[model samples]
Target: MGIQTIPGYMTRGIVVNGHGQRFINEDVYPGLVGIEALYRQGMDVWVVLDEEAFEDVPEAERWGLQPPHVAETVAELEKGMGLPEGAAVGGDGAAVFTLGGLATDDEGRVRDRDGGPIAGPYAAGRASSGLHGGGYISGTSLGPGTCFGRRAGCAAAGAQQ
Candidate 1:
């Protein structure tokens, strides 16, 4: 299971890799952060925040984790975390789902490379690419998933009958 971090925590901090190099911009959606972290830093990533940034997070959004490690300096924090001398820091980011999927028609039929619907194998929801293009907005999949999933189901049912 993955621990979900709140947007407030993500946007207010800088994400660094094991080498203490800053990567993605912290202002975008947290999903994008997860993707970039996985691609650029593998699993060795951390979000570094200042005192104000840490305090800005509401207690409820902390996911019941213990208080963050306090340190007088970045080197001190890195030493405590067992990282290299310059490495910066937490919240392990795990991608919940990918953004893109199989191309599908309105009826949820899978689309071929030539842009025609395949004969069988209808896909919907996260299984097929629908609303998302490049970036993701939280909860954006729910509406399209329901509508397209129903269309796919109805189409499949009609074909069966």
Candidate 2:
């Protein structure tokens, strides 16, 4: 999903699998969360938040998912949600895009192992690692992709000339 859902996971809570088992550290970037959710939990995940944590989330940030199930305690919440006795929390990941890409130069030329640009070929967007590294922030992809895509086109054309 978009950055709007950041507040949901970045809450004063923990993320767990269907079995009420904690998985990834909730403090990491959202991209890391998505990776962990996809690979480890297979997207079967939940965000366990106490009342204060739940209240802190604004309605707009909920991302139009079904309303949260509230209860007097974690066990009750878990029961109501049909999770294992202790699994008391959650969210559905909308999308998990690739994080890193091929190494490239400023002009969008692909880099060789020697750290020099390869001739004739150029790359950009998610196809080239222009700015992103281990973590991801929503909205960071589009701008870099657009900017570097243009740079790559220019560089490719210049190389042909």
Model 2 lDDT per residue over 59-150, tens place? 67766643356788767878865688644335533333444446798999889968998876788887775344455667777988898899
Clashes of each: 0, 2
The lDDT, on a scale of 0 to 1, for candidate 2 is 0.66
Off by over 4 Å in 1: 1-4, 87-161
| Backbone clash tally (model 1) | 0
TM-score of each candidate? 0.48, 0.46
lDDT winner among the candidates?
1
Clash pairs for candidate 1: none
Q: Candidate 1, which ten residues in sequence have the lowest lDDT sum?
A: 87-96
Q: lDDT of all the models against the reference? A: 0.69, 0.66
Off by over 4 Å in 2: 1-5, 59-66, 86-161
**Model 1 lDDT tens row, 1-161:** 12235667766776666666666666555667666766657756666677888787888877664434577887887876556774433443433455445788889899997889889899987677534434666788898789889999999999898
